[model samples]
Target chain A: MTSPAGRRKHGRPTISDVAALAGVSAGAVSKVFNGTGRISPPTAERVREAARKLNWTPNPAAIALRTSRAQAIGLVLTSSSPVPEVGAANVGLISGIESLLSPREYGLLLNVFLTGHHDESAFYRSLAERQRMDGVILTNSVVGDTRFDLMRDLGVPAVLVGTPWKPGVVDYIDADPPSAGIPETVDHLVGLGHRDVAFVSGPAGFVLPNIRREAFTARLAHHGLTPHSVSSVGYSPAAAAEETSRLLDVAAPPTAILYGTDTMAIAGMRTIQSRGLRVPEDVSVVGFEGLEVGEWVDPQLTTVQRFAFQRGRAAAAKLLGLLGETIEEDVPLEKPVLIVRQSTAPPRSR
Target chain B: MTSPAGRRKHGRPTISDVAALAGVSAGAVSKVFNGTGRISPPTAERVREAARKLNWTPNPAAIALRTSRAQAIGLVLTSSSPVPEVGAANVGLISGIESLLSPREYGLLLNVFLTGHHDESAFYRSLAERQRMDGVILTNSVVGDTRFDLMRDLGVPAVLVGTPWKPGVVDYIDADPPSAGIPETVDHLVGLGHRDVAFVSGPAGFVLPNIRREAFTARLAHHGLTPHSVSSVGYSPAAAAEETSRLLDVAAPPTAILYGTDTMAIAGMRTIQSRGLRVPEDVSVVGFEGLEVGEWVDPQLTTVQRFAFQRGRAAAAKLLGLLGETIEEDVPLEKPVLIVRQSTAPPRSR
Candidate 1:
């Protein structure tokens, strides 16, 4: 619609209309909405009433431009897998982060990249230079990750969601020790008389999987034993299945196998069953990351429960703190715990 | 870093620096990156080389402001469940959409909200008025949805990802007939000698589940039979389990049950087994939205394969088309198909 003067008609009212109705300058109306600038309490109330009547809300873009804050956070997921494998932990993390960010009216700028297919370095630089996000939450830290330095150089505040490869490299929130439940898993298997245990780790370069592998190795050494085998593969069902088949083909196959994630464990179980072996009775299986899908499988997955959702929330809160927002400091997340389920048991006496 | 002129020195060069190096105006450099304005091929190459030497990339925000295009798409997920149940389908959809958007240098602005906990209507309005997205992709269309009208009034282009409650109200990409594959499911069950079939549907207000329930009803009516029972519940494992337990308690319990999602079917199977009943043999089960998780569960679930990832990509392509981006027109998605697995069989004779 257009007015007689050829001005385009906005069916809904705008700030200028609100200001006119409230008998204040447009800037004064903006001050009320932005919660900045000096304005009398009564004048603010009048401006609010006018806004309510006109149904006018400040445009976020304009606010962003005025305040030099995008009012958004960035989350970039870089996976080498063909299919984007956003695990249940990642889902939980996203939900938890949204829980906090939603109330604050902050949007999440999510970018998914299949490692080699995209220029991740350029993406980060663009985000920082464009001022698209006030801060970013980084996940899946790798050994010698260059993102931390990149963010620092670009002057973008960031918080890492997993263990940093090097301590003090960045502000991070991690499951303390980064291998919290691995020792418990080892003790559980050893207590059940499992001497030959194997581990199927996530891709080799990831810090989390590396920590987990080392923990499994060190814990087994404590039992006066060593890993029967270790396979490093991408996080995918095919990878898990192939690794499981290879392990089963060994002369003295492992009595128990630990997987980097619950999804991997489920796939491994299917492989074992397809080979005509029973889980736990023939070969015990364990997983990391307590995903709900673990429970629906025939033999519920025995897993190391990391509070991914809470960690996501904590990471967001930490980022908000860095942005100078006052937040209630929550108790730091507890270490991951082992949840023993039907997938694991004493190995059969051969 | 600071220069002698009291100007902040960016360690990395800026567009102006690149322009200076190339002996061109900053606007010329912006034009080269944005691919606009007339410039000789050789000059463009020289500017690119200067940018390479300076390691400069155009800031997205500046480009956005100059062009009035945000270069992002908005996806709002509204759910009533306590936990954000971003099912495998949603995950697939996200991955599919990202597969296209990432290469175009576009970002996805994702927002998750628990229905009543957040004002969804206001959020949509904000997204439209703030120019935060070039367009939006809407999912989970409810009966008598107001979003369609709102988007229309706001003049924001949108593509609905699922069946529209009222056809022709919005541009949509959906399984043709919306009830595709239901007839096959009914035939598969009926041919397996299951006369008393019950259906468990997702939350009642959504268009997809309502269409599915109607399809089941119409198919059974053709067989001169009625549903043993029908239960409408939220799409959650707890809801599915509780409904399954209730269904089993009926005097004339269903010989076969159909579920709205793979996750729900998995939960239902667990419930049946918890009652000491074997799947297929005791009660046949079928699920929809053929998620990969179904394959890992014992007695792998039979399901209606909806091709969620393809649908997601289609939705994105359609949105891109609406945004005036030249995208390859993909063949329309085929009707959903039935995948027979171990979960379904002839019900045991009473």
Candidate 2:
């Protein structure tokens, strides 16, 4: 086989070269090629043989010009924070997308689109003009997201990875109900003999926080139980720790606390210990969103974890489906699983 | 300003339109475009106006066929495991590079290059031929790195983000000496009246592990103090925690232990408490990397931190320097700083 290094200063083998070797006109070769029409099978085979002898391959750029398909997809983290916890879903979403795209020779272009005044519409338009990405997965979608309408009007293919702000406009895949793990989390805590369980929720602007907060409250009420406190705070680790301490100071302190996220629960664990308290013995702690750190830390946390990898895979498959790829068999998305470890136990006997 | 919604269905203005507007032949218009050959001042102004009126921009694919600049940079995380700790530096590096590139309209393409079987050389060659990235940043550069020669011969600009396996082959930047944070950690421990200090290092395959290990041992020796133990192990949290427990079991237990990463230190802290020991009173723990969680935990960890954001910015600036961008004033990299918090104290009085 002719090697790229051995090739002369002459650029890629031209259609004329293939035509001359095959004893055919350039017009005949063009017909046999992917241009407009097809030539006789015998002439096409001869042209293919001549092309193979010269180690020539059709240029994908020229093909892209005719087809208008970039064969690439984009992923964006819709937050400005440099902190990793903010876009934790991106951790698995990336690998899942890579697993499928790399095999099919698709380029995955990723970037962060900071919320507010970033001109996301212009960015998508630029991508289309430059042939950067054919479709995108928008992470951290908020309620009443104008991006849905913007993408729709622009005629760009999109698959949102969060609960959709507007229904029927874009394809979306989130752990269904946005609170699939919360009811089970409450059940596990109540089963562990905890009555006064407080729910510390994340920021209110996003959907998951509200979903987890309401689910926790409603689930407890369903069991004829009352929460000691419900604190809503920003996505700061210190703020969560402070709120956990405040709950501890209340007259009716919760025997167990279920935090809206693993980030908050991990930080709260430290606050409980610093205040001369034990993990399961003094107050049980449960975290939503299973993080690997939860397993590594002391008294491994029992938390609710959405299968971020499977979610990413499902989202990517849906995008391929939009691109006219036939889905042979549907891969079922695994339900949210609760991981119980050393972080929870029966409430201490008075 | 015409809105995108109201724009005509006519495709991106063709070269024929621009040529007609300038009253010049298509061949002449191609010559005047991209400034390969200069045109007369009056003619150039007329062409520019015509192009502006037609809403025509230089097609990147056609330009790429002439000059081989893709105006894009590539980054790779060379690990197979989907662990957050593995790609920690990417969080800041993405933003730092984006801050500089977005205004210039450059694309940043990132993907993982798995180690062992994946051919890094073939990857670079394909990128050049496909116009994916004109340059790349190799994040997990290893000892005897061959990628330097591959990129150099392939004539692709590359910046290695770690200590060069062999110097002078590639432009590289790491926290100067890669041991910038080790000495201060020992100094703080000694100042707190801890005589017997132990060192727990990371996996030996990577440069940072060996760098931290040697620095920890050398610094302790410089104080005329012999270390209680110097253990080198894999990058597992459980292994590091187990090492800490073994160190505690010794007849002469270390008063303070310096861990290789914030990850290992967090796990070790739990082991101390699980064994019914106080943080500073029984055995003080200091982490190498100053992570945010370290600050949120019970006794905030006393550790040394490399400003990852500034390092990322510096690495990017160096890469741009390689790309022939004139950097007016030098941006000196910040040195590693030691942060003393509640994790360390004087040894308990016997």
Candidate 3:
């Protein structure tokens, strides 16, 4: 079989072209490269000479089909990234996945999820069943999803970038949970003599919003304090500011506030200042997610930082292992730490 | 010419399958679809009958070759977008491009520009020279670039997302500049009764940083005032805050500042407030690019906004035209406006 000329015009010569030049079958050329069957010395010499003359190497995709046993894997990204937190992290995740796939000769296909479409899961099924990708990594997965079930039915290996809910037979790497730092956070705020603390979280669908809400309330209960929580938070700075304004205007306003994400925390702090209240003075502020922008402001944001890049590496490592590769050393992520910045201080003695 | 069954195992039926089933050439089957050639009406009936049985259409890539005579296009992305601010814009651009390609049956490949790579242009040249793509869209093109020159030399169709530097021959659509409201911006700042105004621009390689610097200086000159411009800038929040800090501490600190991007303006505002200064009370601030986060802050952000999605649509429209599609109604972006929020108020009298 002779491969098309256009694909080989400026790229490495194809096995078919080498076979054609050597007066042999394409399978013979492939076998010579794979070293599977014993060939007459003269035929092997002819194939080798033709490959050398063309500076030819086997196509990575073709090799992946034969050896790696998979052609491609996909990373599905939805259009709506509510919190402005995932851009850099997504880059890190993709780069890490590439690090594994490049060496194994597998291709990565990016499948973007768009709204106003019929069904997002259908896209994944088509990719795996029709396009025949080995498996896929789904980002921004929701609370109840059909995509996971579809992958399961198709027997395609799947990995979720966020926590898998009620997933008995699925593999996943959850987003850094604020649950891990609630204790330190509560201790620090209480040590500063705060009794009434309010919490602002992202939208119900995102960041497993309840994870932070439950953790914050439980931790507050543990401290024998009143829990004032705000759920209906968007990824916008305006949402946080609006909630902060309402919280401060209450008859019994809290002495401190905790935001589910760094962007929200920073915006909340700005809103507090705009209302003429001092951070940590009138209302101490805390953030989840270790965003770099948290440090760019004055009174650096006292936030619980999540290592996105390292988490990405972890996801890629997990996916590679599922692909049947012997596991190498895994990337070490700094345990979620309470990054104390200038934003937190004792409330005014009351 | 029936397509192999394995190739049709999962995908929707393809033209090759019809040929295989009908025991005819793929070209003969295509002729049945186009209503061309001098095949007997009975043979044509057989081809049509086979197609109906399988339910297949011609692949657009194959059709594009015979009809549009155009090759595929790629969009190159850089991995420096760490914040949510840039993510939305990038998505807008990609989706706009997708709007055009989906109907034409061309695939969009994303080529990420990684750091630590010695030659950026070599990547594009190799893609084109090796016949990987017919052309590519270079986002964030730098000054004195070799990519444009290489494309010109190779006779490849190219589109740029940003302004093409020294681009004498390349086809490009420059980003929507805040041309309609610069005078209003200047007037508002000057009306605030402040003479000392500073401009912090983006990197020298981007947005032709000199364009903003020179425009800002000349605009000040136009208002019969001297200009203080920071020409060396990185697309980072820390860099903006540091510059804002140095400017605020100067012997004759400016009463107002202009930032090249919204992220910078937001960071600068935070830095100013961190120093125990009020936003509009201490200094007025302005930003270019209409980022949604601007509305989420206290006092809101007084900045200019860009129509990234619409501009992307325009870029796609231009490339589609190059791909042999007739240009229709062009995407019209609303004129750039200088938004005046509470961040800009009359400077406190010295």
Candidate 4:
């Protein structure tokens, strides 16, 4: 009889070796290992014992090919900037998603493409065609996003990380209404005796920005005040500076300004101070997204905080459930809230 | 007499079908597609023609299994924070790496593990045993790092993103010296009449903080001046605040302070203001790692800037070259430079 070590010296043990040692057919051993084609507990134990003795483990690549499971999740981002923004919210989202996925031994395949430089549609098609991921988490949904139709046509499972433009189009995880804190923000500014308040929003056609802009408008209307001015700009520092300058240069410039994101608000604050005006004294600034950097800035920004990390975890969990993973418990998402800091105060008399 | 559509109605065409149509063996068809096991150009053309006609594309999973090429890169980050700092440098690094890999159709597998929460060694072992990635990019090298030996034992290819502690252990890409900007930083402060200069560095054992501190010490000695104080702390806002306070409470506080990172520097600025002292007036401040958020701070941070994005691209390119991929061109790495902003100025008379 060949010793186990002597057998291993020839080559790595195969399924047949385990089956031969266990006095079973290769089919039985395969079934026992794959948990497919029912077998008796005693026979399974015998096969397992033989395999453990032989020191053989199934190849993951072979298993993936046979089972048609990639055991990975896809996340593709599109950015206009050469270096995509690594904002606190984005980092929190990635960390939250990994928090759950890592335990399950699933990998996250991340890709970022510069807008207009790569054909995103082709990439999605290749991913589906190659079956590279079991499912994907989509973010930054735009109004009338055709990616929904593309995913559906490709028969790919997907979950959106932002507000869904069309209800029932797909499952989504977002800050419940995303405008939950808008009313509070408006109330705070209005209570501060500011009649002229303006909103600087993200570019049009994005679902989140559009939703936020409408929320700001409705909240102002509820207070019986009309917006002094509203402008939409790209989510870039340059754009933020230019728009803030335009707002400040206006005759009878607004006493307070609300920005779509904390990053934009921070830039606006810089622009305000560079022009020799003080925060809250000349123009009170409010921002959305309670990023940690907000506190580091002078006059800590007063903004609405969204729990991106929790949302990311929820989205991943929902995707896992769709992929037939047993979810231990449903993760709850927190609502956005208004965090008042030194950046906002009563506006000075014009 | 079956049409291509009629044949497709049965199932997706396989390599056998292409071989049969091209009057060649399956091995020939595979070799032609994989660019392995040399075949005549005309024979390859014939095989390609048959595959195109049948609309048969080899399954990527099957190819990966047979070729043992995962065609992916791994990046694992260890952070003490729940949500790791998503600083501009980190974001740029990821973006830069993806800029090169995405075009080559290689996926990036990114994992973040919280320190002490997960067994990082076990993770690396699994990554190697499972062949989940062809190579990995490692960052945040420390003194006497054992990971280098582990990678060697596991036969895993790796590229370090920071300075390698031991030379010839693995290929590395870092800001040349990382301390290249220190001399200029010291010069700027000394020129501004800052005699009592101190350096607040990242925690001990981190290679970067150690190198920067050594550079600071040597430069001060060159100027015939001694450091007022040198304290090592964790790279956290809380740590920065406490250390700054401790330094201030001393009998004779340093007139100028240089921090290991921009985040810590920003926090120090806030601490200085909270104590009723103004920046660059009572005490001048400087920081390393010129993060974009630095510009958004009250007195825009003056610090040394490292091009993390470019380094990321260089690291990825090097890893690809190690994995036997044809690197088109070498990506040039930029040295660190001191960016003078509003934070640094002549100190006030004691």
> Each candidate's TM vs. the true structure?
0.90, 0.74, 0.68, 0.87
Binned by DockQ into CAPRI classes (incorrect, acceptable, medium, high), candidate 2 is incorrect
The predicted structure with the larger lDDT, 2 or 4, is 4
True contacts kept of 3: 0.02
Residue range A1-350, candidate 1, lDDT tens digits: 12211221536677778887888999998876664567786897788767656667776546656776766788877777775545556788888787778766678888887778755766776567567678999988899999999899778899999989998889998877888999999999999999999999899999999998999999999999999998899887779999999999988899999998888898898899899999989999998988888887888899998887788889989998898776664636777999999989998888
lDDT of 2 by residue, A181-206 (tens): 88998999898889989889876667
For each candidate, report its DockQ versus the true two-chain complex. 0.47, 0.15, 0.10, 0.38
Instruction: Judge candidate 3 at residue B174 and give its lDDT.
Output: 63
Write one digit per residue (lDDT tens) for candidate 3, span B1-350.
Answer: 33455656778876678888888898897765543355676786677667656756454334433433323466776645432122435655666665555433343555655543324543444344334345677776676766777777656778887776674656787644624455567777888787888888877766556666666777778889886545457776778899999998878788888887777888899889889999889888898776666765555789876766666667777876775656565567566677787788888888
Ranking by TM-score: 1, 4, 2, 3
- Scored by lDDT, the top model is 1
Residue B18, model 1, lDDT:
78
Model 4 DockQ, alpha carbons vs. true complex? 0.38
Across B144-171, the per-residue lDDT of candidate 4 in tens digits comes to 9888887886678999998888788878
Clashes of 4: 0
- Considering only N, C-alpha and C atoms within 3 Å, which residue pairs clash in candidate 4? none
* Kept native contacts, fraction for each prediction: 0.45, 0.10, 0.02, 0.50
Q: Is candidate 1 or candidate 2 better by TM-score?
A: 1
TM-score of chain B of each: 0.88, 0.79, 0.78, 0.87
Residues A221-309 of candidate 3: C-alpha lDDT, one tens digit per residue:
78887676555676556688898888988888888888877878888888888788888678899988786666655467899877766
Clash count for each candidate, listed in order shown: 0, 0, 10, 0
